[model samples]
Target: MFVLAAALAATLAACGGGGGGGGQGGEDVTVASDIAYPPFEFERDGEPVGFDIDLLNEVGKRAGFTPEYQNVTFDGIINGLRNNQYDVAISSMTITPDREKRIDFSEPYFNADQSLLAPGDAGIESVDDLGDATVGVQLGTTGEITAREFKDEGTINGEIRTFDTIEDAFNALENGQIDAIINDLAVSQYEAKNSDGNAEIIEVIPTDEQYGIALPKDSDLRQDINEALAEIKEDGTYEEIYKKWIGRAPEEIPR
Candidate 1:
């Protein structure tokens, strides 16, 4: 009887039983992110570090799971989640109606907008000045969507160059390969500050977008993560993380 009971216990453990939750049940959860986007998710010394990293780590602590981050491109995260290739994604992904149809999202965590970045001497003060210029954007990002909208409205007559990552777009802009770049405002500000005056934010385009923690559709972890996120915001931890990576206390916490 003792031998039979021990074998049964081992089998249950191997089958991921004995935990009182759905899915990972306090185990390591696979987290997908685009690690090149700074002030959000980026690598330092071969480890992920940024606002999204810090925030998600805290959420994991309260949600009774540990996140194992998987570095991937921004455009692939959604499909990866849809395919169950990743458990969660928090790469500064803005919550959108289209994406909500394909995946679930935690409560709003960060507010964002788009910005026009150009060389300081490029004379590109706004989107209106982008006529006949090469405008760079990260593929599958809200920035790219906004730029396309501008083109559709005849706001600019330019080549909308798409890059796999925002860093690549920034590099292209710095090297004079693209006349301007349209990307997230906070990220653009960080780049402009670190660019030694090479690039500057020419215009702040308000998109009224809010970022959220993304998960596979109907994920059981959603409630746990949302509860943890709410607690973090209520207890002032969110502001600390925000100020640490974003360089200022957020004027308002996203809902």
Candidate 2:
């Protein structure tokens, strides 16, 4: 079990941005998240709910703070973090070099990869079926990375349809506008489970990228967040949350 070693005072300080109006007794904090991504963060019955939402709520409880959620877009999470639009971003944001340059990341809270999904009747069983076929992806995402790789290898033909969001990408797939859509496995699983058996996760892509909480760079918050993240994993909170959402906990560090 990994233990969070930072001072408690420090962990609370990282959430020190945005309006401070949740009564004078508790420090006020606001979290920015792309609510469109389900099983991570999304709206359910007019309110945001998901694993990330629960995890952060627990973290706030343990750390002594109150959090306000702002439903922002995925493309805007990083910018919002940097611009001080929110205290932190919990949009299932993957830590990457391009993002690292602009903001800091909490220790990885979840490890997952993009998955490819196709229609059952499309005869698209594997990556081979995607060869010379028009693939779909969400703009500016790991799905786009997988699509480009397929295109470069000449396995994917036709134009790649880029949607502004994953929901749009899946909508395109269901309408037969594209052969398949690639996205995070957790998100893929959520779609499949909720699709009334209309969609399925055809293949799990092999990748090692992970999701982390995003914060502004050069802020003392980074150290504290990493500590809190480590604590969550060290305790049973991380695995507990995983099981509640996806049925099983993933191998923490990724193979």
Per-model TM values vs. the true structure:
0.90, 0.84
TM-score of candidate 2 against the unseen true structure: 0.84
What's the lDDT for candidate 1?
A: 0.92
Q: Model 1 over residues 1-255: C-alpha lDDT tens digits?
A: 999999999998866532233344477888999999998989899989999999998999899998888899999999999999999999989999999999999999999999999998988888898899999999999999999999999999989999999999999999999999999999999999999999999999999999999999999999999999999999999999998999999999998
Query: In candidate 1, residue 246 scores what lDDT?
Result: 94
Summarize candidate 2's per-residue lDDT along 1-255 as a digit string, tens digits: 133556655667766544454542456577887788888888889878888998877776656657688886677777787888888888887888888999988777888788888876778888777776777877767778777888889877767888777888778777877788888888988888888776888998878788887888776656766766678777888888888877876666321
Please state the error at residue 178 of candidate 1 in Å.
0.3
Segments of candidate 2 deviating more than 4 angstroms = 1-25, 253-255
- Candidate 2: worst 10 consecutive residues by lDDT? 16-25
Model 1 — TM-score against the truth? 0.90
RMSD to the true structure for each prediction, in A, is 5.8, 9.5
